[model samples]
Target chain A: MRTITKNGVRIDDTFAEAFPMRGTALILTGPNKRWARQAAVTMTGFATSVIGCGCEASIDGEVEARDTPDGRPGVRVLIFAMSSNDLQTQLVNRVGQCVLTSPGSACFSDLVAADALKVGDLLRYFGDGWQISKKFGNRHFWRVPVMDGEFLCEATTGFTKGAVGGGNLLICGADYEKTLRAAEAAVEAMNEVRDAIMPFPGGIVRSGSKVGSKYKALHASTNDAFCPSLRGMTKTALDDDIGCVLEIVIDGLTEAAVADATRAGLAAIIKLGPRNGARRVSAGNYGGKLGPFHFHLKDLLA
Target chain B: MTLVLTLKVTPPQRLDLSVLLPHLLADKSSKDVAAIDLATTREKITVGDLFRIRAGSAEEIRFEGGSERFDGVGQGLQQGRIFVAGDAGINAGRQMTGGDLVISGNVGPYAGSAMTGGRLEILGNAGDFLGAPREGELNGMSGGLLVLRGAAGRRAGDRLRRGTILIEGDAGDWLGSRLIAGTLIVLGRVGVSPGYLMRRGTIVLAKPPALASTFVDCGQFASSFPAVFGRFLLPESRGAARLFRAPLRKFAGDMAVLGKGEIFVPA
Candidate 1:
């Protein structure tokens, strides 16, 4: 493996492979910021990776009162799934359950993409026959009556056909705690990048996985190559000085966004330096055969 | 440059000015436009005989004067703008699918009748049957917006299937009567029996109306629609959204008909 030192941390000359995903955004607004954030958080809950959650989602950012449709504080959430059909189903189900139930919560579309899912159109049925549909200036919305007065939701939220997912940064250090600290710093920097979201818990993942497990039923298992405990038993990629490695996965609406986020993350980790955070920074890939988009670490740093 | 048409003489009878539509005259020269025959009930006069037509692009057509005998002022207009400096006769914007029709002075009966799309701005008062359908038609003003800065005559929004009508002035009796579905907001006081026979629609009045006994009061409603709807009316009200929002006392009415319509007056 090729490595270069930057900001006192070794940079591995590897790349992160990202696959295409269907991406969509939702603007959840409430009478107050607290409720708006609550609805957004509740809707994005348990949506870490698409493997088990069926989707990957997180809060993109916060919108001020003036920017939201209802003139209230709002939270923008992004969700990514494997297919357009899957994305439509996931968003409708999530918004119906989480955002609709939240007090004083309303939802709108944050994206103006060509392809859109009629999420509110389906959810308005909950109001029975009392639902009112309003259209103004080419935009349509539904007012569904609920216990908290009514839930105002846009008729549809747009989705994009080509989004980038699985862009990751693997931070290796002498120990677990320091490596985790490095991943956290990288995530903080990544969070500032627009059009990208880190959906993992605390924006950090300790269990990185490879393609397949030893068992026939499983399609994925642990990455033993980077595990410190499985050193000589398998083909190990870790050195004697490296005791733990952590990862931060990023999903973005565009390839350029993913690249920008990866650069910001790598720059933040390298800025932390070896003494305080990570000893080395690397990326995960499957020889780039699985995905069309590739982000080389050295290319990003340069 | 705007196409200017000045009335040279007062026609003896009602003249159909619908022939002056922008789309029809867009590619035509002044001479060609003037050559078009104008329909009249009592006289035969081409556009050239009735007006002094100035050669200009058809994107914006302006009438230097107005006449009560000019009927169907802006009909079947798909795009562009039509401006009338003075009073317009009946059916001022009949069946207009799109574009802007602005009348600086008062308009006669049947203003904006059967218009499907576009914006009609009347700076002065409107006569009877404003935004209503033709005599035999069942639906009127299917789409688009109409902002009237002055008062309106009787039977406004009659059988309106869809669209929005905003009158900043008072409305005569039988306002929004027989309205099927649409929004009609009158900022000033309204006469008796508003929302009469309306099956489904919203009629918001800034002042109280002489309501009919058939209408049932729905009491106070606490909904997000007022503020949400206020945002949509902001630009139409010169950016003063608060002027369009008021504590509304909703009355679900036209019980004499389908009984699904609602009228909102200031509480």
Candidate 2:
């Protein structure tokens, strides 16, 4: 790939290819902001990649009490899956296990779309016939009796079918610390953009993967091409000077959002420059034929 | 264009003005609307006989004047707007699936009965049976909103199946009697025996009332539902939602009936 140097960081011309996915957002409210964020953080835990975790999720943003429907502090969470059915399944399971059990927590839909996932509609059975339903305007909600008090949840949450997933940035540095710093900076910048989320822990992916594995049963395995230790043993994508590589994967409610996040993250890394030990920036994709969305790093700089 | 109907004279007997519904009056000219027949206990009087009709589109029909005898003012209205500048008769906005009905003055008994969907705002006092089911219907006020800015007579919200009733002023005796399922929020004092034989529903009272022996005190607990419910009600009223704060006392009872109904008051 052709490379251009800017702000002391190498920018590859390669693009990140992303697939279309189903995504939804929910607002989890609690008596205070801490509890609401706790529930959101718990529900979004272990949801890093769709290949293994069945979904990708993270806290999109924080909402003030006045901005929320429940008049309580809330956390907005975004979830993405390969299909609508899987999205619904993951949402119901996560909300029921995490938010429902949370004390004084209530869930609401932050997204409004024609397609919907029935979270509270199925969770109400936990009430054992004691659940109460209330409807105001076109929206409906269910109040299920819980040990703490009641778990109030909206009947359905809206989902977008045209979500973009797997938008990424590959950061190569002179050392591990610099690579980590670059990834951290990129994550911080990307987080400011709405409608997108990085599902990884601390928003950095240390163990990135490729589509298939050498093992017969495994659908994916670690990406060895960029491995510093495997550079000599395999056809490596890394240069001799590179010491470490880390990636940031993003999923967004729309293609534009993913594009915006990708541009913002790349800009942040470049701004950090070589003084931060940042060496090069690139993106991973399968021959440009897999995913429909192509976010070219060079074009983003343009 | 807006249809304006001004009552020429106060009729002696209660008139079944349900025919004034949008569907019947829609797409009619001034001559056509004037010839429309209205049902009464005696001979069927034409619309031209009682009111002066300035015809326009049925999308928004206004009554320049109203009376207690103007029964079923906006009944069975599927969609459109009906504004009664003065008092309305019984069952105003009754059984309406959708629309906005504004009664600027008082209404007789059975106001907003058996409404499946719509908005009914009575600016003045309501006689009795507000949001109550009709004589034989199994459910009352199953869907829709009933907002009474003034006081209501006895049995307000009797047999309410589903929907919401917000009373800004005091409500008379037997309020929410036989309430099946729904929410009734009263900002002022409620008369004796609210939720008398209620099967299932919620009655939120601003002022605690005398309870019957059949009711059991459920104690006060911090409930966050009021916050959510209150936010949902902001579009309807400015102060109605503020009445639903947490830490309110709960009472489950009417053991004489199904016993699932609850009454909540400030602890």
What TM-score quantifies how close candidate 1 is to the native fold?
0.95
In model 1, how many backbone clashes occur? Answer: 0
Best by lDDT: 2
| Tens digits of lDDT, candidate 2, A1-302 | 67999988999889999999999999999989899999999999999999889999999999989898877899999999999999999999999999998888999998999998998999999999888887877888988988888898999999999999999999999999999999999999999989999999988898989888889999889999988989889989987779999999999999999999998998899999977857999899998998899998998873
Worst 10 residues of 2 chain A by lDDT: A130-139
Query: Which lDDT value does model 1 have at B80?
Result: 95
lDDT of each: 0.87, 0.89
Q: Which has the greatest TM-score? A: 2
Q: For candidate 2, what is the DockQ?
A: 0.59
At residue A270, what lDDT does model 1 achieve?
89
B-chain TM-score of model 2: 0.95
Off by over 4 Å in 2: B41-44
In model 2, residue pairs whose N, Cα or C atoms come closer than 3 Å (at least 3 residues apart or on different chains), thus clashing, are none
Model 1: residues >4 Å from true position, as ranges?
A: B238-240, B243-249
Chain B TM-scores per candidate, in order, are: 0.95, 0.95
